[model samples]
Target: MPTTAAESQFDELGSLYEDVVDWPFRRDIELPAVLHSLGDLTRSDVLDFGCGAGLYTRLLAGQGARRVVGYDESEGMLREARHREAKEQRGIEYVSQLTPALAHRFDVVLSVYVLPYVASRDGLRQMCASMARMLRPGGRLLALPLHPDYDPHSDYYTAYGFRLVSESPHVEGSPVRLELRVRGVEADVTAYYWSRGALEEALHGAGFGPVFWAAPWPPGLARIEDAPTVQRAYLRRPHAAMLDCRLARAAE
Candidate 1:
């Protein structure tokens, strides 16, 4: 698979990818919304794009998906995924990239926190097009990209153990770089800041329709009274947003 600068950063942080599971905001807020939006998977042939360490890939298979395949651009991450596959024998296939022959092979494509890494508008377009082509007609695409409204100036991210080392202008097409620390180890990550309008336009151009956004917190989890003051505040300002879309059906 072709490697990009963003993928290179992930490769460097390969060992820490799994640690993301412990991030409370992601574990408690973002991921639950993604899973809730998925609804059912028992009969679906699912594609887990950017399946770092095969976390969700394994979960999908365990959820009784008929078939599950994971694709990631990082060799280091794939190695970890493959190791888990070998030990667990979940019958999941891991690949560095989606092949042309796999076009329209999936009933659902799940990409979590992936698109922001795509540094250019053209790159995002190509990524969306590839995802559209991989799904059968009427297939669903569920993604969680960095929230377009995220404030780099706030201490909100600090609660999650991330600090903004530096950032480009908050203008469209610019990149926001952050430093994440866990157990005294730090990794620098970069992601492109894409406006919500641009993202929706790209999805529609790729033949997805009726796109909708879901808040980071699941239905019952956004209550301010149920959460700590900090968490309640954090819940109001999401770090990521859910994108739910479906491929257009062929005309009868």
Candidate 2:
């Protein structure tokens, strides 16, 4: 049977997880520095939104997050996350919904490279709004998304004329890599690419302010390795609204 749109998306994501799992940690990099600067995770409630394979959730728990929740839309990914949790004996919870049931606000929320798949403007807005509401006042949200400027579909030897320059703007023309398995079944994946302005506008429209942006080169790994072209955005929620009331107001 063919994969559903949701399944196809995750099938691609699962293929890329292997590359990311050994990254930063395997190379001893400073990828977490910018996020940690936003807030102290020690004994703080944290949620790893779209926490594929629960790698970052484990990281946060190991770093002493009071509670770490991992939520994703992929069952295969969640199964792997649960297996890892059991093997590591970690206390992170994995849910298969975009927004799981949580009564109270969290101290910090972080999402790594999961926003672009959110192709719908309304859905994306709802996600941002949900994240903001999931936080306590002054809580922070740090997310990384694909650089909007990078084109992922255009082939290298296209109709347009090509010339040599001092340097190339990309490692791989397409930052995302799609891998298929033995039976021609697609499996793992990784994605990176985003523009600064588009990200800012998205967050601002979502009601988040005081954004901090950074493009830190891979701390210990070669820049060309893994097509290291990621952008990080740090946004803090100065205030939060009641979920029902916010929706009601928006509907007014």
Q: Model 1: per-residue lDDT, tens digit, 1-252?
A: 224447877775666877887787777776676777786799999999889888889878878899999999988888889988999899999998788877899999999878888888888887888788889999999998877877667456787877643356457878778678777788888877888998998888889998899777755753668875656756776767889999985311
Query: What would the per-residue lDDT of candidate 2 be over residues 1-252, giving only the tens digit for each residue?
Result: 111124446734554564554433223333444344434577689878778777788888878888999978787778778888888888898876534356235777776656544534454556666666666666667775543433334332111111111123333222344333332333534332224555555566655675665443334334343443222211111000111111111110
Backbone clashes (count) for model 1: 0
Worst 10 residues of 2 by lDDT: 236-245
What's the distance in Å from true for residue 121, model 2? 2.4
Q: Can you tell me which runs of candidate 1 are displaced by over 4 Å?
A: 1-4, 164-169, 249-252
Best by TM-score: 1
Q: After superposition, how far is residue 117 of candidate 1 from its true place, in Å?
A: 0.8
Per-model TM-score versus the true fold = 0.92, 0.63
